[model samples]
Target: MTSHAQSQAIAPKGISRFIPILSIGVLFFIFGFITWLNGALIPFLQMVCELSEMQALFIAFCFYIAYVVMALPMAKILEKTGYQKGMSVGLGIIAIGCVLFVPAALTALFPVFLLAQFVVGSGLTILQTASNPFIVRLGNEESAAARIAFMGLLNKAAGVLAPIVFTTLVLSGLPEVNQELLNTLPEMERAALINDMSVSLIQPYVGMAVALGLLALVFMRLPLPVIEDNTVASVDTLSPASQNTQIWQYPHLVLGAISLFFYVGVEVIAGDTIGLYGSSIGVENATTLTSFTMVAMVLGYALGLLTIPRFVSQQAALLGSAVTGFIVTLGIVFADDSSLLISEILWGWTGIQQLPDTVTLIALLGFANAMVWPAIWPLALKDLGKYTAQGSALLIMGIAGGAILPVVYGGLSGLTGGQLAYMVMLPCYCFIGYYALWGCRKYTW
Candidate 1:
């Protein structure tokens, strides 16, 4: 084990350790609530802003690309601020971004909304960089994935609520917003309807801004235990032998980053695009479709909480996730889009809305994806010691896949339709399966 892991083994025991984990879980909840809002925002903005499918996905692009652009810089800031204060700073930044949405809504401008997304994403970059490593290093290395699974449970739970809450607040009373319907109306009436719907964003965002600002204050004063590793700040002080071991020398970490890129791509595609796909297939209240994906993920995380490090090792769980993801992606690609048979067998009696077969398959992808992040983080950061912070930043940068791949899906969906476009996920799962089986174990290139 690395020195950092050894130090963590002697970290605060009993209730003290639980406090930090609980605090970080709150941060993960914030991450999910803000990040997954893009799912509903995608179709909502597409209608409000008069965008094509590809343009609509730029909502995801501008949001996630900030991770790549700002991660290294955020790492630098964390080195100076330390993890606790940096989290407070991150929450403050997110609050600022949320406040920006007020102006974006008032003007009904897409550029302004894009700007708000970039700002919110930039803030999340800091929180993600700080909080992920914090959770991994807080306990025994063997159980780290389990800890992260618990956090994932919280995150995905928030994800389940975010879209439903968004649909309730912003879309509840609005008229249907497809272009065909708009084109059928008088021009003046269409503009007025779009303007009314756009402004519906104001109340919820203002509430988010206030709640986040208060959370920032609470986080700033929270009594969290501090870990004593040098992180990135003291890298220059290492002996020549330690300094000679460049981050590139760790093949597992590098490959893990690449694997994470594909993992996040498929995760975002499943979470965000499901709504748009449902809309195209004539599902009512398509914005709430993300809740179905989130529900699946929540179930997966609950399973992980029970089995990880006990009934199953993190590595085995990861392999299972990849295999399941591969099978589900195939179902998404080939399932008959008009069939409600899958939904009927699954939840038809619950009185919940039944999705078409293809859409149901896409939601199952969430179950396949839930374990990937939890499993990968501990495995990738294993034995990095003082390089852990840098490794975390690298993995965080891999989230760019969320920004890039969905746009690719959007463009491809335009050509081949939404169902077949899921073929893109096949190679992604293949790569993740490779990582789970072999790439994670190869420490040397």
Candidate 2:
């Protein structure tokens, strides 16, 4: 066993250990709320900013791209600030970013909003760099997946709340306002009306800014535990990529990065695009459909907490998630006609409501995704010991797939129709499943 693993295994047992985990859980909830807000923001920007399908996905791109840009810098920052101060700095930066929404909303500039997302994502990069590996260091290696699952539950519950809350505050009028926004009109008049229609944006983000600022202050004052290790920090022009020439030396780490990259892509697609997908399919209250996905994810996280390391192994959990993801994506492809017979039978008998085929399958992707993140992190960082922080940085950088792949989906949807564009998720899940079965092990590359 690695020294890090052994230390945690024989680590002192007390309420103090749980305190740091609980504190990190709070940070996780904060970022999850922030991250999933992109789901609400994407379509909101479409109408508010008068963006094309591809342009709006820049909302996601900017947010996730910060992880790639800032991961290594954040790692070096953590080396200086330590865990508690690093988290405080992250929260503070996010608060500043949230405050930027005031000017963005006031001017109604899409680029400024994108900038805000970028800044907030940068903050989250630092928080994640510190917290993820720290969570592993907190307890026994075997139970790491369970700890992450518990954190996932907190994370996803905020996800469920975010779209609902954002929709309530920002998008009040259901479809009528959307129809007005989409309808033909004089360009000057349409811009004025859109500006008026989206006047609620400032207040919500101001509230978020204030909340985040207070949390940052609270984190600074809290007595969090310390872990010891030293790294050479290069704030010079030297890039982390160039400095770590030997990063690719770890085959499992590289493969894990690939698996996480594709995993994040589909997870974002399922969470962020579902509302838009529902809208295209003519579902009433399309934005509300996002809650269905989040609810499914919450259930998956809770199940993982109960069963992992006891009823099911971490690798087994990952395999189950990936297989389920593949089945659901296939179900989405054949959703309409395939469900017709079952719909008819169910309606003919008890008269219960039938789900829209696409949204139903999209929602199920949430359950498939929930376990993937919790399982992948532990497996990827399993035995890295001193390299654990850098490994975490690599995996976090892979999260940029969330940015790149969804924009591809959005642009493709515009060309080929939204329903057909969902084919992208299949290959993503296939990679995750491959990792689950084989690629997670050492020398499997």
Candidate 3:
């Protein structure tokens, strides 16, 4: 080939390899933005729709449950078509889901909103199934954790911004609208006024639709590297034949998956429920309360971007994070209300400030949860070879813990008030701690 032609071909091939990573990062961002918005949405929808505490939390349940429902199917689709095509199809699904928001909002139907979230989550499951494994295979097996950590930074960065943007656009104005209606309008007019609040969601979701469409188009044009799995199974590691094997077959991976499941559930409970939690603790302006969690998460991602790979191994990071998570959970549970000791401790040591003790502790969990995914994934899928796709699907399904655990917490809150209910996070962290200490060390099939 001519030198220039060779250069062109080589460049596209190199770019193609990175495209799946990039596209997956974008998909992660979309998921983060959509998923984290629930932090704001639960409270916002609660007021607009006049839902009870438990009822409003169904917002999170409906959205994350799609992972459980769609993960296996997403794996099946990816098996039929490679990751690249599956990613494009996933983005298309998300676009359709985003468009669903328009009609859902117009009708002022809360269930329709939940249904739309389900569709969006379903799309994300497919994208995650395809993208995560692709990113892992992009380089040396040893460095998979580091690469996934980099992706985690991107994912969490989107998560950090999502609540801020959504709250500013859809929720910040709500209190004023509610006040004005209450002061001047009659009872009947209040319903119309509350119904009009749904209109705020229309523009935001329309923007999401446009962005998703453009991304889908870009993914279609990008040339991604085709990875073929060819590793043969031995008694040494997990294989498809291991299906008949005990959950202990891949002890480290299964433990890692369990840790991930619990970590995600706790993280979501922290961010997604903090606004309402703040309200229960007498903090008004739920929209602004989310800034605490968002900022803390941003700081953690910053630390990961700066220190991971070069400065620390993923295992060390995971260990340190689990320790911090346990400490913070304890603080939240046991710290007295009279003293702001936890807040002072976090601010003085970590330089994160201007947050309530409860809120600050929840944000600290973000740091603890930051490296868990990166540390866990490579360990879980280690040496899986040809079964990597199916293994990844199983890991992805663990995300349903995010869906299940929060509902449990929400139900507890309904039964015992939000403050006491936060104790649910303690056992979740305990499971994560167990995984970090010894769960990632399985040396046999």
Candidate 4:
């Protein structure tokens, strides 16, 4: 296609085109807030439930595994309801999950908490299936990464806020709760302290449920514009045999899904496990550590906004991000764990707290991961056309990596300790680099 013709075809006529972007932007913001809260919840529940690191990671597993279990079903629902109503239904489901937190908190039951996480993850599965392609299809194909990056900015910004909000709202006035401290306490006293902390969760979750419910109502009434699938290949041009082909016939899409699996696994490990690692290493305010990763992601998103499609193509960005992620994962494993030198050099001059070199490197993974999703979505969904929903669901299913890998990391950490266990992320980035270089370009089986 000529640049001029592509511009006309890609660009929607007026300000009205931006309305769906604005609406979906709200959903992305919500997605980040709910997703990153797992970081804080991991440490908090570990202490409250008196569980080991491996058990605590089940928090992430239950939550993200829901994406795998629900993605295809949610995609089917979207076909019936279309994107707009599907999004509203997703929001309502998330609200229901938030309500579950109330009962989970009052009972101080870890299983209940896991169930709630699964419910929330299922809701997010629906939103992600609908919205990712929505953003990509909203603009010129070449600049799709830039549009997704803009949504990412909002998403990461909420991620930055989620940990701080959880700390302030949920952990305020709680005694210094750690394994060592709890171990020293009498059994009854430890139980009392945990019960108190568990009750604090009730108010915040109730508020979130109410807020999400209202958003669901707004999305229901909102007249979100339906985007036409202009890129679908016409049946008149396809041979009868070609018309019967399955989604798996596209090698690029299959490879893209596998790439996303590894990408999401490493991403979740970097964002959610940092808190657990920090706490294990004796950071006083470890629950808020996720904000550090989120801040790095926001910065990365800003850089992507400035450079993507204008200064660089999406594939180049994806390759660079994968390379960076691999390097950072090595640093996390081999860097001096006791030294705060890295943090001091990077941002300590601002009077903020300094992290050990290892923690700092893990936070840097957020910067490395920020562009991967934005870049991969455009590249993977490039020519799937009418198969977009099925392809998207396949991609969404890859999010199970987040569910599985952190548990793997938890197990590895148990065996080798936290620092060396990050080696698990190395090959994940390697595969993403492969996809950026070759897999995304392959269309045949």
Q: Which candidate is the best by TM-score?
A: 4
Q: What value does the lDDT take at residue 89 in candidate 4?
A: 90
Point out where model 1 deviates above 4 Å.
Answer: 1-10, 13-15, 176-180, 231-244
- TM-scores vs. true structure, each candidate: 0.95, 0.89, 0.87, 0.95
Error of 1 at 178 (Å): 4.4
In candidate 2, which residue pairs clash? Answer: none
Q: What residue pairs clash in candidate 1, if any at all?
A: none
RMSD (Å) of each candidate, 1 decimal: 2.9, 5.2, 5.0, 2.4
Clashes of each: 0, 0, 0, 0
Ranking by TM-score: 4, 1, 2, 3
List residue ranges in candidate 3 displaced over 4 A. 1-20, 171-186, 233-249, 336-353, 443-445
Residue-level error in angstroms, candidate 3, position 303: 2.6
Tell me which of candidates 1 and 3 scores higher on TM-score: 1
User: What residue runs in model 4 are displaced by over 4 Å at the alpha carbon?
Assistant: 1-15, 234-244
How do the candidates rank by lDDT, highest first? Answer: 4, 1, 2, 3
Candidate 3: pairs in clash: none
Q: After aligning candidate 2 to the native by TM-score, how far in Å is the CA of 70 from where it should be?
A: 1.0
True-vs-predicted CA distance for residue 407, candidate 1, Å: 0.7
Per-model lDDT: 0.88, 0.80, 0.74, 0.88
Point out where model 2 deviates above 4 Å: 1-15, 172-176, 179-189, 229-245, 337-354, 443-445
